[model samples]
Target: MEGGSSTSGGRSWSIYGRAEITARYEILGSVGSGTYSDVYRARRLSDGLAVALKEVHDYQSSVREIEALQALHGSPNVVDLIEYFWQEDEDAVLVLEFLQTDLETVIREGKRRDGGIEVGEVKQWMVQILRGVDACHRRGIMHRDLKPSNLLIGADGVLKLADFGQSRILNEFEQIPTNEEWMPQPPTIDQGVSHPSVGGYENQAAQEQRPFNQEDYLQQLVDFKTRYGTNDADKESNLQDGDASCLATCSTGDMEDDPYKGSYSFVAEESAEHESGTLTSYVGTRWFRAPELLFGSVSYGLEIDLWSLGCIFAELLSLKPLFPGTSDIDQLGKIISVLGDLTEESCPGCSKLPDYNKISFNKVENPIGLIACLPNRSPSEVNLVKRLVCYDPASRATTMELLLDTYFTEEEPLPTPLSELKVPSTKTTHDGGSLGEFYNYGNMESDSDLEEFGPMDISTTERGFSIRFS
Candidate 1:
């Protein structure tokens, strides 16, 4: 069969060069596009059920997402993965449940309809978001990116976490050895042997006819580990640091005299697969990035997600981003402006961060507190945010703890009933290509479509470094 094709409401949809998938599901329309994948809304031919066909272009991202989804199967508030097709030397196509809209859309629509989302509605959304996050954390998974766009909502008013490309399973950290000799080698699958398929099976009698060689298996395992596993040098260095410990935005030039000030394109860097016990700091959007991540701390945990949650919660209360910074340096400047300086006292052990000393800043005498960020909002709302957005990751409240806070219990305006939620009308995927609607929003995607931040200037004066925000 020619790669499946269909047209809906004068829009055409086609899946290119995948005959096996085409035979099973009919491509409906493009949902969104990302740096590593393109998501399409499709229909299963067997039962006429609608599902999302995620065409993952990056092999590592695909593996991470598939592994996460399988482990998180049946989790509450987590997106459901129906099935997937992975053939050698080709992109993996994951069939997932299609969610109508996302939290970002809800926030935008609420802004347009009313001045802000109703207090009760905001509470309900937060509850659902927390539930999704709790599920991930309980399973030892850190959704490195937890911005509004990644939180999907269905007609049933349920919020499900999606986009596991940046997710990391903490299990590897537990498995990593403290000594060189104790390092365990990874299992190697022989190339000559075809991997088992999810839908098909091999004949047992034919497989039994083949001779097994223990010595060859051991040699191949050693060879594979030597080529792909961690090198002796990396192992030694990484282990030494074990005692110690640890997105994307088109950034403005830090200096006014910089030549690349006016013209800067947002180039998304490919996420590198990290060695066990280490993580890439380049994860999540700049606005929701945690202070540790900002300071270049590689060793982190679920607390990073908590900080992003705090940002998202703040946005819901105010209907705008808590700190909308243009550049990495500027982002830190905005945060420090509101939360004061990052210090040993404010955040114990913060100085130990990799780049904490590298990036210095002028102390803020009068820091604009979280309450000031949420004007007219109840104290409960501010308390909820304060527990998450802090200098110390260890101090950030866990999702389960947040779920039990008075914000959700004993509050005057309780969480809105799920049945009463106004489900957003599902918009058809754009035929004339739009930015990352299915996975992420393009550069323009944010709570506010306000004009981009003006050019910022970073001064390296003897007093202290400061990025002038316009």
Candidate 2:
């Protein structure tokens, strides 16, 4: 991971308390750059082994990514972390096994068969994605920002999960329902003057001023945890313990007989370090986001990733975004147009989301389903897609369940081996996908003569640029 006696191409670079950076590796060229870091392809000076160097501007993000990647080093579908060294006081450099390109680039550059990738290739990539994500979830981690761009591919065509910047560690054994602020308890009459009420405030309704109240929402949320929440049996048992966190007046037998051995303290006592932010709304790129996230549920779990996997699979199969919306509101509308509408009965606790009650959507009666949209795909394939993109987050397929699906296991259309795929893996990002923010053709700011230009006018207004790609 570090220095040898080898000299790096007649130049010298240095880091704090370490050997010169140039002494270990030869900088090849730049790959890409994101908000926090720049990716580069480099070769180890000692053995000439190719490696990817990510020069990070933010130390906090680098440390968080290092912790996550180190925890998931051996997973076949995940990227390998080679080593890291400091560049400056607030900057650090991460060394990783260099990959050729990413899945997004493959989809963009690969020829479209019937307007999508070959069904076999899509299956191969989807299975690999689920396996890599499973590795993360099994280890109690969640890749919060899972999209095509972050999923890298090597020359051997092995898909690796990269970019741990937005990942989260979920310690279920120690976690409470929501990280919320506890109200100051009223004093007792024993000390000095007459303190208002002790046991009284606990029974009263919460004031509307509080953003989230344990008295109203916390207890209600516990009551809403039906048998259908998580797809995993083991995780389901863990969620049952979540009930004990809210019920303060449970019988002595109920408290003693709890399966978790009373490890779960009250939800109120848990620290308010919940979602990555103080108030978790949406944190991912808009298109791949799940319904629960759109509804603004801060208490959502790993199933949200499953929803994203569904969207990715659809994009791979159709060679276009499944639900590309102009904004958050439009995104939700597009989802309903496909999955129908959501009600409290449909998703059970969806209404409890912070923003759920804030907006309303039209109910779609005969919305399009996966089978019709992916007409080229087989019935089994369609079923898996339906399960993965289910309206209820509780019902989406877990990574383990997805691996066991007949569509993947059966021999109807075997997955094309990675080495056999024709697409060349090279350095790229969602292949000009950044143009999405700049060119939302469906909802451009300026008006156009639709009769004269039609839908293509959004991108082709200036020239024949978009028509050439389409």
Candidate 3:
């Protein structure tokens, strides 16, 4: 996609082409695509300001995310969406405020190269994440997906929650409606005893029944084969493959007819709608999958987000994912190993989840002892992790509880804002040209670059103040 100029209402503005935006963002040089959406580093042509751009192919998903983000503006801890553009023939482009790094990068770097993050720093990071999440919840929104990669660190060292794509906005009555048309319905079936020679009512049934579309069935079978890589013949003969669990659950009576069954669907229907309000879908990096989702809970809400946060926090502390299973069953086992077994008493609502009856439970072994796994963590740090990782949604701590925890209060002051932090100047060759012994010229070049790369001529004071990187 390329960014270009466009007119909205009566005002004219330059919009970078989708392709141009991707190139300008310069992310191609840093990391391979890590998300379903294509990401890039982009520069605003009007003022030459740098920002990140994400191009979404699905129009519905794009609009949903944009609406959610617009509601979150003015939040200190939330990542800001600078601008968005859509055209009939092109993918939606979301221009976002650029950030220096994400928590995932920081964790990996600290673990492999610089040892682990200091205990105080971990507490500070958690405090920032909780504050951001709290702000969202206060505004009647649930992040739904709270992973390390989604937490972005700005150039000013401020942590902001990005990716509202999976976020859900609650109304004043604290309810969200589900789209009924997307719900899956149970398949009708006929059952009867049969004998070898008794071809009873075959012709009569053919005359009374509507003709089934073989092509449509074939297409569905093809899609299933492509997704699961299972042979159609094998599926026809016996549907016992582990990979077929999701399909089996959906096909059988185990799953609900309503798609939004596990979501927050009880919100009153007559409540006033915000300028924009809608429930988002399940979206998160693979490793952060919540047990409720994996087990096929239909109407789950913020509890899923808390699960992801726990996983992220654990990874941050141990430098390894707490549950790194490859499949749903494996993922559940990983979680069970850490949290102990899930019994009827421990997980009261387990039977309500789809496919719950299919799997049997055994005494779960704690593979990695909490403190031993996070060898670098202190006692307080361990306590915080336990609170966040609680299996029961009601038992999990709220954002406020986390922020007020002793970890953040007792930690040393956070690092100075990146905007105020000075960058040391060092002599270097520029395009094979020597600039040494030319102090006056170097100073002039620096000023010129600053002016050219500064904020747009339009005042952003109304929106927010810019952080000056010295």
Candidate 4:
């Protein structure tokens, strides 16, 4: 689909009335815009073939995106880069295969109170997303920013990974080790017995089982309330006032702001061994940013993207972000409050992060309960997401492991094919008519990244806060 000649093979229409690229591609209209480029629907003069032309204005950023697409040329579940060429005082013209729309549009247009999309549709999209990520990882690359917007759809409903603006090369990254000593192992099948030495030590491994006692649990809760400075009168009053009011009065003793209060120490344990491109920390979008990234981890690798994927899956299930913090500090507060108080065991070496102790935060435990946030998800589905979005990036599931999760093998909600997706296959973008509505680019002056932060990569850092990259 070269533009050297017109349909007559002599000369083409000069600048299809927009830019020099119009000589080759007939500009239809604007499709969408990124931080560094504006995508337009166009048709080639040689064959009248439809394509997407991304007008990349920044040189360095464009190079990174080009390198990523070139490395993943023929990989499965990834978009194809048709052709690319640059002009001297203008933007670089990147011709890509046209997609019907992106996953972001689908999610937004279909938002509902009854927990977003159906289970089958989410399962299908999850499979496709993981497959695309696996392809990238296998080739030693990391698609740093993988929000819904980056997942594109075709006329036939086939989904593919697109927009490598924030992607990075991993030529010498460490392999995900099979010797997962740090990961928890499945319990062995064995007989269980009660021990008189311990208090009510009943094991599920045994043939017989006994349900837990609720009265005793309440007594323990009362003790916990007592230790935190609440009186017995308050507890009695709470019982009469109802459970919701009772919980509002409970305290956590004191915040963990004092370094000497606990035996925990900030220990340095390098999680991954990436050789280069390691310092630039701003990775995925704000709400999807991993705990390690918020805590200031500059050496993280592919697992960071996995955390973002976990958030995306959660959003698909609930029709909202799992952690939608307005700022970085607020983001951490939301994570601990919803995911339960993080410890060294929960996130090994988390204290060693550069910004770990930079601010003082009151210890906020999960009041409504961790599982309460995901009430509708099955146990296996919840378990899978918990592992991927866990505090420790090193322990996150690889793309292949996620794709092979038992949740996919279950009999109930099977994945739906693209042809069955209830969305139109030929629609384009509608994000037009506003300056503030631009895509997430490097808001370095405000928010940044071409797409590493992604379309919804809102700023999380407060003004004048001394936080490291990412």
Candidate 5:
């Protein structure tokens, strides 16, 4: 679908209309854009309620997103999808409850001001996110890509889950593809010397060609472990020294002195049964990928989402992404270095995973030692993070548990509700121009003309849209 327009008339209408639904909400300006969609701030012509409109590129993907939204409508913790429509020419428009800003933006801005998000505020948001996720889980939906960017804060201080593009409806027979096609096959080893063979008792000498570099294959396995496996020496040093400042520094976005900068060292080479270009193979953003996914586990589930939550929580606290790995493999290394390693015994079905055969690690690392990495973090905060980021899906804390954690309850109270936050009702006038002048309907022939522009000319440039109440 084409993006919304930014005309002054469009803005006024968006702010004042009450019962009117139009081809476009009339974009005040671009809010955000991704590979497949663009989001804009708009208003309902009927009620004048401000909303965000997402215009998607692919009809099928848009349909899927709408289905996810339909499943989440009426959910207090989810951004409400009020309605959606397909214009005459197949342009899809989804009207969403508007949010003031996203969590990532808020956290980043706070960092620039040298201020940290209040611990209490963090807890409140965490609770809201969990509430939304819990609702989704009850409906058998998994938000595969749960991250800070997807969590938005309304002007009234309400937190809601926004993006559903990567979400999936889970069921008994969900057809998750395996990763066997993505990983390289292990080289075969020769058991003995080849002997003479004959098809029909006629002597014929045959020599085995031998499989590709077996030693090199073994070395690769060793390298994977050495790089990703937790180092006891490093852990012990941190424990003995009790130097958490270094760890805290790692959590922040400042990466100027980081060792693995400007290198594609994180993502491990793996082939999927599905091609890389396909939607399913596109794992989440590198910084937020869970350990199982980073390690190439094919049968992974919602625990990955929890892992991302843990990372986001850490980032929120530190004003940076928790593990800023340049590649997938490196990302795994950062996780292991901080949270320790996972073994077959701990992760019971791990070996059965697609990339399990490629792993050569023998022992799992200790979880307690890993907690020390978050310098100055309270025990309650660490406990919550660990519970949310557990390797075992069953062991991972439910969203409800996270919401009720003591870190939020004892540390601080929830922020004032968004409805009570004092945001200006109108944009500031510039250059002595009155705000009403931009949307002055002086020469407007009829409301019908604006509504009858068809699908192609729907555009707006106004700062706000108007909705007239009866």
Candidate 6:
């Protein structure tokens, strides 16, 4: 959106389709910074409303976050994007709803409590998280980076999902077009030939045309992938011939060759040339990263988010991280040490992951299960985590399923009322005057924290700061 000249005297600044940012809102102070963006707390001049000004430096990240927010406009559990500003030469600025604290702070707050967060409170947070995740997954969007720091809490004690810069629209048909005016129109088809169905050709004139149901289509694809796993040799051929729309609308990674290769492939095959079409494996915080991602699997799906959800739940139950690894290799080692050996029997088609053969570890004779990770937790609570934190991506529980599980379904420890839930303030400091790691927007870590990790691009860099739980 373009803007006119501002009321200010000197330089004519156009911002947010009206006056300059300084004219519209009073900048309070800087809150957070990341590789691609800087966040500042601001107050709208007209309404005196508190909002976050996220000045995005990276062009691609700006577009991604904007698109994702636009697509998820009315989701109650997702963060609200109030407005944005983008000009020819200057950087893009997003005006978001201001949130006081995050889930990380809530978990820390719970630690100080007599017995940690109550069961009902934990269930409430999980319910909100699942609702947000289910909204994204149902719409064919992958948050890619789901962690405690990224989930924010407002004054009303409601949790909202945030930090969408790393999000992606997986379905090609559902992709939002940048400029519809510039988009090429599809060619007209002949009237005689009928569109091909999953199995055979159909006579369009003879049959009643059914309206396209994306939800049903996606569910079928999930059921198909779950049963077939990644070992079906004819999977690609079947998708190509029987249902071309499935590949375009439902497929996640490379179906035939490497199941771990992302759909955004630049290279068709494994060759001497630089690896093409490979998504950056290092996208999330090390503590909650999925094993497939740790093993450099690019062609992942919503399952990665489920794994992170499991980690978050475990922390809520125990008031500590389930696996706090020092590095990527150590992260995998920690998971292996708990879940036993990573094998084909444990996770079918796991060997197909790009880095499965590269990373090796000694098999644990007696692996400590999720129960050990969450001591004193009830069987239902532990079972809830086990449903998601597993070796197989397909085996991981979907948000819908988790919401229906006995842990959430049972009436005893019900989700806490919103008024009963505690909400921490962002201004709250710990360890004297130091600010907590997760009390700001954009969910970024300082450059000094990642200096030893080597240079990386905005998309590939480690996003969240790690809190090593001894």
Predicted structure with the largest lDDT when compared to the true one:
1
TM-score for all predictions? Answer: 0.74, 0.67, 0.60, 0.66, 0.60, 0.71
For candidate 4, what is the TM-score?
0.66
Of the pair 2 and 4, which is ahead by TM-score? Answer: 2
Query: lDDT tens digits, residues 362-458, model 3?
Result: 5665545566656767677677777767666555666665665556765555433345432212222223232122111111111111122223222
Q: Tens digit of lDDT per residue, candidate 1, span 118-226?
A: 8888999999999888767655577878888888888899989999987877663332111111111211222222222312322132222334354553454344334
Candidate 1: stretches off by over 4 Å: 1-15, 172-278, 427-436, 442-470
Q: Candidate 6 on 1-470: residue-level lDDT in tens?
A: 22223324332233333346777788776676555566778898999999988777665566678777766666789898776766565567778898888888888788788988999999999999998997776666778778887898898988899988777665442422111112211112222221112112221333444454546655655664464333332332111111111111111221334223242223223221123323332356667778876665535666778899999899889988898865444566689889998899998777765546543555689999888988898988899899989998878888877876767877677999999987776634444233343324222221112223233222221321111121
Q: In candidate 4, what residue range of length 10 has the lowest lDDT sum? A: 241-250
Displacement of residue 380 (Cα, Å) in model 3 is 1.4
lDDT of 2 by residue, 242-266 (tens): 1111122122433354343244333
Clashes of each: 2, 0, 25, 8, 45, 3
Q: Against the true structure, whose TM-score is highest?
A: 1
Off by over 4 Å in 6: 1-19, 173-278, 427-470
RMSD values, in order shown: 11.1, 19.1, 24.4, 19.6, 23.3, 12.8
The lDDT per prediction is 0.66, 0.58, 0.51, 0.56, 0.50, 0.63
lDDT of 1 at 132: 84
The global Cα lDDT (0 to 1) of model 5 is 0.50
Model 3 worst lDDT run, 10 consecutive residues: 439-448
Q: After superposition, how far is residue 370 of candidate 3 from its true place, in Å?
A: 2.7
User: TM-score of the candidate numbered 3?
Assistant: 0.60
Instruction: Mark the 10 consecutive residues where model 6 has the least summed lDDT.
Output: 237-246
